[model samples]
Target chain A: MPAPMPDISRQYQRREQLTMLALAFPALLMILLLVVLPVGWLAWQSIWHDGFTLENYRRILAEDIYWRSFALTFEISLTVTVLAVLLGYPIAYAASIVSRGWSIVILALVVLPFWTSVLVRAYAWLALLQRTGVINQLLRQLGLIDAPLALVHNTFGTVVATLHILLPFMVLPLYATMQKIPRDLLQAGASLGAGPVLTFWQIFLPLSLPGVLAGCTLVFVLSLGFYITPELLGGGRTVMVSMLVSRNVELYDQWGAASAVGVVLLLAVAAIFFVVSRFVPLDRVLGQR
Target chain B: MVRIVAQPSATQRGRPLDKGGESVDIRSASKHYDAVRALDNVSLNVAPREFVSLLGPSGSGKTTLLGILGGFIPPSSGSIHFGDRDVTLLPPHKRDIGVVFQNYALFPHMSVGENVAFPLRARQLPKADWPDKVRAALAMVGLAGYESRGISQLSGGQRQRVALARAMIFEPRLILMDEPLSALDKQLREAMQIELRELHKRIGATIIYVTHDQREALTMSDRVAILKDGKLVQIDKPQRLHDHPADSFVASFIGEASLLPVRRADACSVVLGPAILRSTRPVPDGDELMLAVHSEKLLIDDGAGDAARNRLTGKVTDVVYQGESLRVFLQLADGTSLSLRQPSHYEAARRIPPLGGELTVTLHPEDTIVVPKARP
Candidate 1:
């Protein structure tokens, strides 16, 4: 008598599912067009040249200079990440525990360097670290040294500049994680007869591991593809994978070799991410949880 | 001038306490935050193995006093003695007191066994003895097999047991609990209160518990201290506190009492709503006084020959039907409101007067408590 009901509830559920998918369609389309397309094209260029050939990849593996560049790139990234973490952890901890106004001021200072261009920052480091620069002049006047130290135009210059740029990346996530930790846990540890150092080790440090992992992953991944700082500060003395790739394209006009280097670096980054995600959940490493 | 009824010593219970129990004495302790005084000059003494509760409303300095005793917050002035040592400047870890925080504060990263063993590790106890101690402590809280479980996987009640186990694992001479049951549901809180009381009796550790719930303080403590603003208003055994509160504020806070303003008739009597009420306790000297009549102490008078000395005639204003009891509200001739609680099955409840119907009630002289109005 009521026209057989028409399964109204089931029909409503179907409409809701359609609405959810419709809402997500734009993001999916953007990912497909922007990210998947470019990456697929890059892979295609690396493997296919005058029909299908693996010669570009073979050249990379056979060359000692390319291998040296890869090694130098990894060494610089690892050193910069370690230094950033060692220096950033205390700054983040101090910011998290201070008064609200002071915390804001500290965070602002950490983010201040990000406003300057990478090229500008690299050049600024050159001025401070060059021979007869401020540091060398001060040391010579103070009689701490007789000759100027070779501070710039090497791996040391590249690392010092990169560390300055990436330190905020490390400190921000650490501060977010440390601020979320409840103060009661520390008090509980103290009440259980733990001194300050023990409390920090057992309670505070373990809780903040997720932030450390996140900061390291971000700095390492970003450093793997870094070009501007290393190119300017390296002064042709310290070569990295990105510099080699760029030289191949500019000097030899070898698009295949450049594409091959890009594919190799991408695969290396993916492998490292897989290994890290296996040990710690990717969401936790990103501080998403 | 109210007579102070001396409470029987806790030792009179005829049970010897465990060896680790220690007495605590806080002498004139005070704390100031910038200009605001969080804790005024307050002194209290707790016997070894005796359980005392600091009971108050929010911002009443109960937590501040607990912090001072725990050595987490230094007092502005005064000293604290555990047994005989003055621990005025000692840090919290050196004080060797176990604290169960309000949130339980179990480490989310560690397993339940590791959390319980944390105190043992801090004290650097023998490694060989840790397993047994951890298991024993977990078993004490009825969480015998939960040692390996993750803290996040447990429910609120289970987490609370884990916290209790961790606090007691060290067997510290003193243990402090800050509203430990406030987060649990009502039924679970009541069950934990009973279990905690049994645990205290078995362990014989002096416990300084802080809570805002009056019923919890009454059910769990040997003595309950009431605080108002930054001062201790009154401290006494639960029964004595309920029976003879020292001021109107204490009377209203500890139990359900309708404080009717009264004029002191003499040294031992007061006039309440056209009735002269005599009290066995002397009248307190103050500009303002109130007759603190407990709701449960009022009885319906049927003009019996053995009537109580104090009587009042009133009209039934409202009747609140609780499952087990009925709250009968009355408006006296002087327009003061009084509440009386009677069992649902009582004879008077069966024939409860209709709204606005006349009724008469009696109050026993011993139950007629008079207290000075709290100083504003």
Candidate 2:
């Protein structure tokens, strides 16, 4: 018997391999069917618009209404991304350097609103930004404005609401990245005679850019597809791609146009991701694949 | 037949050398957390250009003390002086100390050249000299051509060298290294330790090194301070601490010691398991002691006459055939197992003793360090 069939250990190894694959295969199949397949079908529906006519692409590229919504979404997303970066940077920096207990408290507070419904956030903004809302009332009472100052139902309201919802996404990754940076680099910079502010700008800022890029990308991509925030806050005055696409599907029942708009949004997000990946290695930027 | 009250100071014997050297003085410093003391009235002085290593185990407050000096943390109570300035209250950035972390903390985003040039550029040194200084610092660490390499491209040893270059770039009056070479492999660690010691000597800059590794501390420091339980147990030249440790902790911690239990008989004298040792320091009346017999201090043989200073018969329990030395574990007649490290090159007609075989080992009284045992 040639080595007695390679001993019992080999049989045990084969059994273990089969056990691991059996346990993992079901979960893998579920993810692929529910998530990945839907995205692939969406992409195919966007491009294969009946006999490959290319009419949907032509309509998206040629139509003013479609381009206008795309432009509006781009502008709004870029603005929200900047505002989120500004607001999130300090919160992340504070979280990284403060005591562990304080950081935990702050991080919890930042993430607390995420647990609430996005519809609730949008409606809350709607109540606050209406023509006769509390802000206008307060401003009128303070005599800053004799009449209501048109605070609600516009691009301004949409951007504000989107940023409020997306702020945590921006802050968490930046904070996690900041936590990995050793305090010694700051000390080293300071020891060499860089003042606190200079040290922060020269050493801390450059080192934290990967996180900054990551946060901005997250906020921008998320903001681009914001449907409820724009619809509830802007009230159709500020029509973004998501609102336009929804109006086509629900009100007009235009499946082909809606699918084309979806495709446009997908391309926009993909393009941004490609541009980001070109400049920053995604692994290093987000600290992992 | 000995007196040990510090040998009568001739010129304020313990007074630090005052003949013009940079001085770092922590005056009666203490750090407390609520009620527990992390540092208890600790004070130390480092002369300019002196390489002082703080050797201690975990929770010895060595890191706490280093943090206070590095300005990362402030002492709960005390003042720190650098030569003539009172900087105890200053924040880390204002302290002007170069620090090499145990992790080496090189910025992954920047190139090695950029990392080294970081300190110089931060200092706002003459713009023209920045490149030269960075190149020189990198070259000093044998990394002259590795300036532009990514942090990921460098090995662990190269990363350590880059950290050294960054720490030395600004040429701060003092550099605080927190176990800089602890991350490398054993062979690389030895090589880096030798290079770092040579760098310290060549630069003639004050360095306060910290490590739990006793061999690294002893080999690299001009003076080694042994700390235990948040207290400075002893501070002296490496050889002195090796030959005459202040207590059993230092004796056992600094190197391999048999540490056979002993009882004090009188000043300068103690009784081991079956041997008596006369020491340079006085043995207290109530002090129980142990002997720190260095493994290398004993010579073992199978057939030896009464030619050695002191002899004990023991059976060999184990033998490790190291390339340079044969470490033999010996069990004494009283049944305590001790180790003897003999040179591998030691030639003899008798075959090496096998396991469980009995042999007599010889040691001198002075070689058996009589250390005072610590009180519970």
Candidate 3:
């Protein structure tokens, strides 16, 4: 008969659990200190003003300007997500199919802009999209238009700048997923009588949906709270939730209203994530087993 | 055992189309990647419903030939004909061929039924008949009632069956297999080999199989095409290939052979280490000649006055005990090593020759083949 192994296995299990906890302690502590504590404080501030009143919530729900800001935020975020995906899919597919050296070069170019600050990128777009910018100057010199087009300080400027900033977030996930698909599967599909377009639609596109969802979710959530690009490029015309929160804090000194707006944005982003996750697994989007 | 219902051919399902089996003719096919020639100018003809295996070692361009046949790779200078139709420049989707990849590249997101129905959907066949055809194909591969199972849920052998079912569901004229069974275990691989051969017979579809396994080629192929270094060495029936290899490379690649350096005495005879060996076939013209003898053809001399033509006496070097047979290694007087295989149930195994003991073996003239040495 074999010796009893329950005690030994139980002891080993306890040690394994302890080791996992020990290894995870640093990250957990950092998240608690940096993220959870601040969010919890903001949530508390949103409701509790000397006696835990619902005044900030009621005021946000009743205000028309705040509602407009929330609507504009979602509209711009959705538009930016769509544009990023449209532009990023082809770039990601090209990177996935090219040779290793070429793929590295493409990926390097995609990531190169990340070295510069987002504010700097936004400022550069401002220079290019302004009335007297290089694009307007070129159009005028070419005799294309008599008047300068209103490219910046509006929804157009916000979307173009935001898409430029969020494109890599969309492309990197797509490339990761597309690169994992075996080349043989496409060949097999073709041999089974699928043309290039049909094969792409049936095999390649479906397999890449996870990456699309991942990139869209990341871009959308990040765009929800986006402030720098819209603020610098929109020229105070395109008002979003983040800009509203800053106005409430900086100009009006309304800490309660600002905290409430921050909390609402967090919940809205979480809700969008929950809905997307219901359709496709979040781990698949992240390319994790 | 589930009884499979008889079904019409892929083209005969509510449509009057050409039958699936079409003869293939590959003429002077070649592929070059800049300086490296993956496939040299080579020509081959495959009969309708014939099972041909392209057998070679790695980097021998067998897979390249298969790819060229499937239209996956365009040859540098060659034309492919499918029943007199020049399909040289045709795309893979327009070729109407089925391909089974080495990794069994089934769509992971699709279920078994959907995978089997992919080709039909690609052809824009009627959706109403898809379920019945999918079921019939699954039943043909002995995997009925598994339509809804996810790809990841099935084992390796089951996935292979799914791939086969998917390939044949459309009743393609030709199917290309690229080392499909190399991923299976030994016993399973052997079983699948027989099943695949039977499947080929039942479907009557022309098959072009590429594998590096000599045993598999001999077991399942109607004819084995041996290749080396982007060149076709020989193409013949398995038994003929084993008996009369065109050169030393074909001899060594087809089976276990020991090529002994010999001098050609004449057209039908050669001088070995110490004895003159006569071959049943005439020797081809070459500077260097070698006597290629299969290990199984060497028999121990029972001292009954046998009339075999060639005899060799050597010292026993070693004996390896296989499960069903014993492999005896002997070194000739001139230091040429020869291996002989004897069944374990044979009388020779009762008393294995000890190391350093004199062992005399006889070989019939018909069993010995003389071929030219490989080029350096």
Candidate 4:
């Protein structure tokens, strides 16, 4: 007896499914081993310290130090995101419009810091931003100020360093988006009786919103878990969630407390991702479409 | 959500529906980029409500002239005057002229209504008057009730209509179009040429249209300006441009005509290989002359031995069966080859000579066009 057409088609579909699974198996296995297993262990440790009690979470909520760290983390991330947008947008715009050779040079300068160690760059900022540093000395030589300003070892230094480190993240996506905007649209806007300023406001700005959104989301999320720059520049004064998690583990050897803090920070980042994804698709935020 | 606004008469508002166009006087304008002369010493005048087309091949500086007039490109020298105002250095927004781009350039981010309302917003018109104005503009383009549609959802023709509606929504006196129909298909482009003529008549705006298609220029414009190598070659009415071309280049470019080298025989005649052809127009002053043979003007000789018509003998090389007409290719005794078109009816088909057979043709004195060879 010959097999039916539907049966043969079903067999072909089964083979296609098996092929797709085989192609995806390596990456899936790596994720299962590296990310899922560690996160599961952390969650289990956070709750099952003493017969699965919720004591670690309770202590985290009742503690004032943990609350301050969480609040400070959000405050700094917001400030950095806003500053990155203001400072990075013009650089990206300039790069987009310049000649191709100059545009590559500007982009190369932005990416130059990535070749150096993050710790080295953070320490370099410390040297330049300290009291009576290069900026203060120049100001004094110019007779601008009588006394040196407090430029380092505080939230100011932390923000300055963090913005410098994260600016490339904001600029690259903005340049990508701005370069794709057709020059004809700008000319059309002008010929339709719009001045340069009005044309930029109505046409250019709206078309670049995708880049702005993508850059802000990336910088903000990365700022949440930032450790080295804040640690070196914050001078142990500006505490963040990551700092708290490390302190609980290294100083006190409280594995359950550290795991609980880790789990909470992870949930916070996930919640933010969820909210932003509701507004813009994930692929678009990653500058895919 | 789509909002179907209430319709109102154009006169109900204070806007002038009967406004005539503005006269444009471009005087000796020239544009240079680096060392290349994009436009050189080209001066053109356009009367109010007159439709003039700038026709040329690619890189012929037709677009550069339009750009200078539209204020997108600054002229390296000379000035432009609109009516009594000299607007040589004015910016595009302050000049108050509309422009329709080739690709339409409609805002992909805005709805169809918003795209049309953009000019009004830029001019700072009243907020309450937008809905009625947008509706009227859309209706003019035969796209009524499409205000809520997204630009991505519309077809190419619909997008073109939307672009037209947006450009003319504010009713500028001078409108500039840069090859706007080049993106459309052949059938759609022909249909639009007529529609555009009717629209120009109703609006009464002085439209400076740029195109590279010679047929389109002859079909639509009251006066067609031909450009060559950044120079104004010829500017005349379409019929005159077709009937009496300025030179051999203009003769061959404006329509289907073959040029054959000839010598001057008299004050009003020229001599081909063995025949003397008379022209009603004056012979141009040049060292060399060529005769332009319009394919449609040539008739199959009936062997009646007409005296007024110039006759020539040739051998039929090939015949092509076009849908409505038959093309007969022939080779003259002096090695000059030319083709003529005849109707594809049964009688005409039977009259056509066989391939490689001798055939006699005649051209009337009025149809004989002899022009000077253009100086390179």
Candidate 5:
């Protein structure tokens, strides 16, 4: 025997929903203006020439140069991602195990490079790697070479420069994940009669896999659309998808062709994300779990 | 007492491996970090299949001693032996001792079966032997058929059982436990304590357990080693430790005992205030002495009390009802506080005098415990 209360809770919930919507308005608007509009325009320009056409898309499929550019981009990105993992994993492991002060120094070295502009870092590499550059001069002085080696303007130069640029992306996530693994687990492994090497192989490697996937995903995806480092260091020898899109737009003034290539690149990136997410949860790779 | 089962059958149920029980002898073990001594020169001997507990407060170096035994931290100077083999300088993996760390430390990425099979794999046991061995180990810890359960899909108590199963699966003779029950709730902790004691008997492993809980040590250990400030204060059976502490610190640490300052009157007696308290054992040699008053040892003195009992008179300060027992606090004439517990049943509750009333209590000579006062 209590009196029926007024049904104001539903009304209050509606008001709360409105408040949340208002708070989210700015970010939603930014996405619409920055991302949706440009992509929509690209899609529009790719299909519409005078009225509507699939000619530009068909041309990309029929052409060998465009196919070669796509193949080269995948090959270079795969190489860089593999190399970044090999190099970055040891650096992250070192940073994870060292004392606090020394770890700070190591992390700082990784991050300090990240703070500088990609252009400046690429230029620094160019200075050291060019013909008669510091490396070549040193090798010549040491009597190790008769002539300067071709270190730039090829697949080698493109990979080295891109790896330098994207290494922090691979390392920061890996370091964060490695740091979260408890030190007690190593001791527990030892007490369970596992030697250091066996423990590392069975326990540590399996636990840090999320980081490896995350680093590889980031490095590979970023390398696919990479333009600046390859453009500067490759000297037109290595042409990626981004460089092809630029050539269609800036050099040939083919807006339809450029838009088609941009759409394909966007879809490829999306496909990669979908496939990776299917295998491993994205939140875990991002270390949210 | 090392019992080895030669390849347990696949269908065997509740059969834990009877292996890896070896006598441990630690002679003058010490660990020094810079100028601070984590463990002073301490020697201890543990027999095969015996369960010994190292009980102490934090910073008492109980952990450091366990570390020395487990080969995690090398002793600054000492020799340690497992049976006849000297293993003082051996690494942890080579020592062949099971260790249950605080917080369990189970592998997060592994299922229960994989975790239990890790030690066997490290020893390079045949692949076909794993399923049966893992099943046996899991069955021993009361988690039969839990081989496929992920680590995250377990409660705290379940995780503890999994840790124990994984540690004992390889049948190491000696097991080192560092506060393994600390993470469980009170009810679970008590239950696990009993379970662990029974498990020890079944497995026949020499267990060196470290805990700060007096009740846990008393309830489970065949012998308890009490430590304070990196020094071994006393090591004895639970009853001996409670009834005959080596000094004031052990008496206070091991049970609910209120220490009263007294002066030695003779070889068998001590003078407290105006009352001369006599003991069955000779008084310890010391300039200062303390009488340990266990709450349950004191009885209300009637006129017909036995002549062998010593009597003391005090004013009731307070009476506290504690479900099954009533705690009565009394103040002596010289302001020393004494406490005793009485049954809280109807008749006893009615007999308890009002607060501030005079009460006389008697203590038998055998129940009286006196020790040399410890240095602060």
Candidate 6:
């Protein structure tokens, strides 16, 4: 209405906005079509036998076998996460205290296994934690055990393997976060009449919480979908939800049941994310260096 | 209602106030990182109820000494005494000290009242005394009615005042300030400097202030310790450190000055370049002595000054017109140059001083400060 010809500033701005939208639309649609479409289709398949039925969910909820695997998966993940926290915090703190050169050395050692393939790492764990592996062999030579302990193809093996693989995921983020909280803040805490324990409790512990939350979230979420580590080390005895879903789809050739279980796992992850993000902005916590 | 709280009983009672009224002794304190010594053999005595500033350039160990006093770092050598009692091996929490950091390390998670109440809580003070002390400390710093506000809501000056309040809540024996006003703007820093001086006088508590800013140190401190390369170079009053610097570093660090290298020839005499000069006192021979003369102290005259004392003839190289004064740069025939700055009210600089023109200037013996040679 105002102009017959183009106003360069207005036209350029409009063109820029249109171009940005045009460029981003394909990627956006790809995410929606690939991820969102599959998730929605799984949600639909979860409740419907042919048209609409809650039998699959009812069977999952009512059965102890399904419930046992769900509980054991959560239990293994949570315990491994807590154990990793206990083991990782001290190493991170030590790295923060030592000289930069030594800190880098220890840091590299802690995170070095992350560069290796997780399946290879899990297999490496199987090689170490198996019945006649070096650990049991050492125990025998040390006269601690008369026989090799069963360390593989079970819940213990799964947890041990996952902790080994995810130990870096916890330590690196915590080390990065600990490096940021200025050393003076702790010193200031001590100078103001807080003992080292109290300083750790009040300042260090609380400040490192964001990293703890992030590491826990990643470890817990990924452990929910653990197909390789638990599949390899869990040794057919521990049929977790991922292995369960894979068996249903590949072995039984039941697409509907697999999709149903997948939907349940997805919802469980979303639910945990919903619960944790209430205390912390999950994006900010995870996105921070 | 006078209670006789004796020092021994008070000391036994584990109260910091009893140990409050004596100078702190830091003897042969040294901190080393592998081979590099951050502070070396630094033995300093902070007098009771006196404000002393550790003035130095960055990385000169002023903050390290303060950190040791504040119990943040352990010295590789020597002991520290609070009053007459030695407390060298004590951890930070055992030492009842208050610290105000340069960044004004206020607890962002807490309110103003909560921040100020932290020290009292640290001392395990009676619950009843906290509110009264908090009110008094906040009122003392003129931050009344701002108790409920967040740290983000306060201005830089207000944040500093809150920090001061928090540091003094328990009435600690000594307050260790590590450049507390450094993070503020110039106007706010200057204002806080005056406020800090008033607070020191009002409280009469022993304070060890650390700063790289010379003007702030010179203005507020009763005595200033100049540190260079982890060693205490000089410790003197403001006027003394300014008027009679102990060495060339002190002269240059304290304020702006033009140092002309001079050689001692005989008693009451020295030669600056080719010009042999007479002095009021005997400058000792065989040591390299630098004669530090302030810019304003040099008098320039166009007329022939054959009658001048310690007079020298030099050609003017540059004349800088400051709004209030003029800084006259001169190069002697021996290739030594000096800058003489005088107030604009003293107009002799304008009439006859031209670049490359020969001018005569006089350096007074009494006005001149004799600085010792550099330490190896």
Instruction: Output the number of the lDDT-best candidate.
Output: 5
How many clashes (backbone N, Cα, C below 3 Å) per candidate? 0, 0, 0, 0, 3, 0
Show the colliding residue pairs in model 6: none
Off by over 4 Å in 3: A1-6, B1-20
Model 5 spans > 4 angstroms off? A1-26, A48-50, A252-256, B1-13, B315-318
Candidate 4 all-Cα RMSD: 5.3
| Candidate 5 local lDDT, A124-190, one digit each (tens) | 8899899979999999999999999999988999999999889999998899889989988988999
Question: Which pairs clash in the backbone of model 4?
Answer: none
> With candidate 6 superimposed using the best TM-score fit, by how many Å does residue A15's alpha carbon deviate from the native?
8.1
Per-residue lDDT of model 2, residues B123-184, tens digit only = 67787887777777787778887878999999999999998888877667788999888888
Give model 5's docking category.
medium
lDDT of candidate 5 over B1-376, digit per residue (tens): 5645444442254773567479999899888999999888888999998899999999999999998888889999988999999999999999999999999999999999999999999899999999999988999889999999999999999999999999999888999999999999999999999999978877789999999999999999999998888888888999999999999999999888889999999999999999999999889988889999998998888777679898988999999989999999999999999899999988877766899899999899998999999887
Q: Answer with 1 or 5, whichever has the higher lDDT.
A: 5
lDDT of 5 at B122: 88
CAPRI quality of model 6: medium
Write down the TM-score for model 5. 0.92
Estimate candidate 1's alpha-carbon lDDT, on a 0 to 1 scale: 0.90
Q: What is the DockQ for all candidates, taken in turn?
A: 0.87, 0.54, 0.82, 0.69, 0.73, 0.54
Interface RMSD of 4: 0.8
| Cα deviation of B137, candidate 1, in Å | 1.6
For model 6, residues B1-376, the per-residue Cα lDDT tens digits are 4533343432332122433434799999999989998999999888887899999999899999998887778899999999877878888888888889888887766799988887777677898988877887788888877889999999988988998988887777788999998888898889889989867766567999999999999999999999998999999999999887888899988877877788878777777887777767557565788888788777765455545467778898998888987888888887878888877775564654668998888877666555667664
Tens-place lDDT per residue, model 3, B179-289, is 999999999999999999877766777899999999999999999999888888889999999998988889888788998999988888888877988878887787798
Which portions of model 6 miss their true places by more than 4 Å? A1-68, A124-153, B1-20, B273-276, B302-313, B321-325, B344-359
Please give each candidate's TM-score: 0.93, 0.87, 0.93, 0.89, 0.92, 0.85
Model 4 stretches with alpha carbons more than 4 Å out: A1-59, A98-105, A140-147, A248-260, A281-288, B1-16, B312-318, B353-358
